[model samples]
Target: MQSYWNFPAAAGGTINSINNAGIETFKGNELDSLTREICQNSLDAIKDESKPVVVEFKSFKLQRNQFPQRAELLEAFNKCETTWKGKNPKSEQFIDQAKYILNEQEIPFLRISDFNTKGLEGAQTGELGSPWSSLVREAGSSNKGDSSGGSFGIGKSAPFANSKLRILFYSSQDLSDYQSHIGVANIMSFEKQPGQITLGTGYFTNNENSNAIPGLINLDPGFNREETGTDIFVSAFEPKDMNWVEAIRNSVIYNFFITIWQNKLVVKVDDEVISHENIGSFIAQLDDTNEDYRHVKNYFRLLTSEDSIQIPYPAKSYKKIGKFEEGEATLFIMKGEDLNRRVLMTRKAGMRLFEQNRISGSISFTGILIITGKHMNQVFKKMENPAHTLWEPSRFEEAPKEADTAFKDLRRFVRETVQQTFQAETTDTMDAFGLSDFLPDTTTVDGEGDDKKESLTLKIKSIAQKKKEKPKKKLKKKQRNEEFEDTLADAGIIPEGDQAGHSDEEREEGLGLGGGTGNTHGEQGPSDEGTGGAQEGKGEKEKNKPIDVEKRYVCLQKNEGLYRVNIKPEKKFEKGKLEFKVSGEQSDYILPILDVQSPDIQVISIDKNVVRFINLTGKKLKNIKVKVDYEQYCVMEVDLYEI
Candidate 1:
């Protein structure tokens, strides 16, 4: 029996895969999505947990004739052109370019093969629920079991997203003694013949049921797959589109390092291998350099360090949701400096689903929470979004309200554990009338503690009121208020004639100002409400950009007090000054530099907190080193501004 393409005739509008939302979402992010989706599917089909699941990404340009269903596929492409040529410009344009690629000397193909997997079962019987049927024939249908990595079925579209021709071939061998292979295309809606059209989706198979061809007749060259697994051939691959080697390596290391670190997954891209043996080397190279894997090093510590303790459960409490009991989950955390303050959330199988981030409060650290036990995994698996990158309560159809609460409780348990483990203290401030500083400095009435003190402003106001109560001149309301101000001044509540100098406490709470009282705490200048001498230096705010901590950074070498700084000044500024500020918990203070040192820089002079440099009109960025007074642990945050 010969195998050929059949996009059966249709009467009316067809379901074009070109407009497929599932495939469209993965287009721009093909490299990352391809690695994630393929690895996830292989892990979900793990045939032996005792051994690592092996995946190989072989990128090669195969002979044009070696391309499966070449003639038949071109025939379909021909029909694709005629069917939608004038009606749909998108389809017409795509087919025009696709036909050019089909005739190329060598066709690019990325063959992804996985070993030690269950592969696609039910190929012999063509069962609808089989992995083979669900993957090859159906769209938006899944056969993944409980706690599987994916069930939304959109992940299958990731490979096609990388295909410019929008075509792929599926080949798999199951332990059930069946080998099945077929070609599938996701194209725009098109006509097959006059008064006949087909759906945007079509498969290269023999029968009407769209069963995959029996299998491959023989293995090619050195690539062989005797073990049970699947092979996804991405046809019409473009090497220039991306560096597949780096993409595959980084995606696995960033997203599934936990799986590899646990010795459960092994990946080979071209000839490079990434496994637990060399995983650290890969991570060390990316540490602090890659924002995507910013916390992976700390997360690795939590997994491998002896100090990392697993929280024993029902330990504090968690409200059970469905079959997930409070004790079924496990969380381990480690405290360290410079951690990204995130926790890796994953199934017991070790594939990282997503991160539960910003869990770190005063304490800096990284953590990992493994959703263990069958029942607990099921609950979280249901909560995962379509991409499996996040857990959303609304996605859990079991019970939205309860699921939301349970997820919160789960996060709280982890957060509380990290806090308790690190023992970081949060200072309790005296909040007076919702304003912590509303009540001023005071001597206790009974000479008691902080809580029993009376407000000094209120005490002075009471004394002034009592003096005003005595019979005096019958004055106007405005005069009466002026007399009160003078009375308070005489009583030493404020300065003699000072009406505009607000003390620190009064300024903070917006209460009153200092007068005859000895405290002079007027730091604020005239407001910007009017134009005059105040607006002279305020022109600095109009510059194109200000060099902040994010864009300009300093690498402090404590021994030498030399700070390596790199910054780009606003292009519009012809002159600029560099400044340094030592950041503290409460506020930042100026850090005086002893000298500015750099071969490429010429400094004019140094002001109190400013280092004025020579003309920088045309320069973009410069690497310069500055020296500060030698102090063991003093660090500075560098900033720049246009003079």
Candidate 2:
């Protein structure tokens, strides 16, 4: 007998040729999309089980030629299963069939019970439909589920994108029967056409496959279990283009986990459990413990559908929730569906859902909803309709009357809550940082406080206003002058032009003087002829015989003081001569002759005992005597005074 097999004509071509011929296309944000998809699937699986779920990660590397591995296969299965989980049968049945086919190929898989996989059963035949039948059935009922974040059904192709490898997966779901379980094991191989991959299956055992594993193959001698749970094994997974640690951390931060009620969602990276911290708690702790973490908190709520609303519920009494070893206090209130949930060490309220008629329930820790980078852009695009008013109406007059009324009340309530919280926290922090002195201290009043509080606030405001309005006084000029003078005095100098003299007494003494005398002497007069006795005797003879004018002469008496003398003789007498004689009290007078013609004369030369006279001023004198030895003449003094 001869056997014949048919294959594609291009099957023998090189991987590069197959890749370039449109047989593979990998241009997608597949890694990011797949990570999210896988996380969602794990969450759903745990949610379905209604038990604690622990996802353990282990380090494994897939090389280029190692075409298939267990991790990659499990990742692919998760994507396909989650994509068709809640969809209608017609549209998603193909993917469902693919999963079933892959399960049938992975046979003789291991079952474990160490974690939560207790009470599980192995695969049983006659449970799932034929591979072809399941494919058709799944195709008829394909519709996307609510919890899936990715739009494209190609998320399953992500882990296989960059390599030629094969992956195997072993996973199980809890069965209703305590001793029975539904489980699957599968393999996926990457082809040259980038993200496009071929899937095959191994054995699965189940009491019945209720459209659970569409193309699953049944293994003989199914194993029985005492406890029930699922297990996943991933083999050849290509590392994502981006950093894996960052990708996993971000997915954990943003994706919804509110529906995880009974199960604890655990994620591990390379066999290490990633520590999950609530965003609010983390922020609060950072602020309280780290001085640098102090910053403003911006609160926002994002809602997708129009029917979603934020209803205001009445404020409840606050109660202290937790106390730190450092004496820091945390407070909270009992409200909303998650009222029993322990509020974190920080006092911020978590997200809460309120029912109609202002009743609250269903709280969520929405502090984790941080929109960043691409996610932020997506939100902006999605919220473009009516373009969030930021607490304002488009047209105030056109707003519905009922909505307006409710909005005003709600606004007041929200504002009050925010103000109160801000004040309380600010006070607490100021005390902690030793900055309380920088802020004003004011007593906070309760909701029922009176208008007097408003009055006190107004008074404080008035005081501040008055301070601002008061006028400043200008400096006086006199004071400035005095200050300048004082400075000059310190430097040691009298001011300009203040000298000592020019007093009143000096002027008064110089005003009293009059005027007085002048005197001159000396002239020669006629001499009397015939002296007394001779005259008497002669009188007898010729008593009156005329004395010859030229022959007889008598000396004239000299003036009492030193004098200048002048003499005149009668013109008719031909030899008349005038003689002047010096007399000493009627004794004989001796006359010494001196020069009568020279103008320059020395009256007496005392040492030689000589006397001479010279004419001065061109005047000639006939009878003048110069004496050299007379004591009175030699001692004479001449006095000339200002007349």
Give all candidate RMSDs, comma-separated: 18.1, 53.8
**lDDT of model 2, residue 108:** 23
lDDT tens digits, residues 1-643, model 2? 1111111113444221112211033335444443444444344333334444544434343232232333444455465444335653532453454444344443222111123433123223223332212221122221223222322233333333422222233334344432222222323222314443333322232222222342221221233223344433333333454465554444443332222211345555443343333434433333334211221111111121232223323432212211112111112222222121111111111111111111101122111111122322222222211111122222333333433333343334433433353345445643346566554344534435555342233234443334565543421222222222223323332121111221111111111000000011112222224111122332232212111111111112122222222211111221122222333433423333232322233332211211322223222222332222222321121111110
Q: What's the residue-level lDDT of 65 in candidate 2?
A: 28
The global C-alpha lDDT for each of the candidates, from Candidate 1 onward, is 0.68, 0.28
TM-score of 2: 0.28
RMSD of 2: 53.8
TM-score of each: 0.66, 0.28
Q: List the residue pairs that clash in candidate 1.
A: 494-515, 494-516, 495-515, 495-516, 496-516
- Highest TM-score scorer: 1
> Candidate 2 at 293: error in angstroms?
14
Q: How many backbone clashes can be found in candidate 1?
A: 5
Tens digit per residue, CA lDDT, model 1, 1-643: 7777767656766557356788888877888899999999998999998999999998877788776677877888887777666777766778888888889988888889999998888877788878887887777988887767888888999999888788888888899758888778887666676666787777778887777789752323457677689988898888445777987888899888888998989999899999989988888778576566667777876777887877744533334455455667788777766665677888766777777643433456778888767776777788888887777777878687777767766777776787677764333443346554655544565566756776544334443334555543321222222233233434443332222342222311212210111111112222223211123554444232243211222334556665555443324356556665565656656666778876545787664455767654344445566776646434345455554
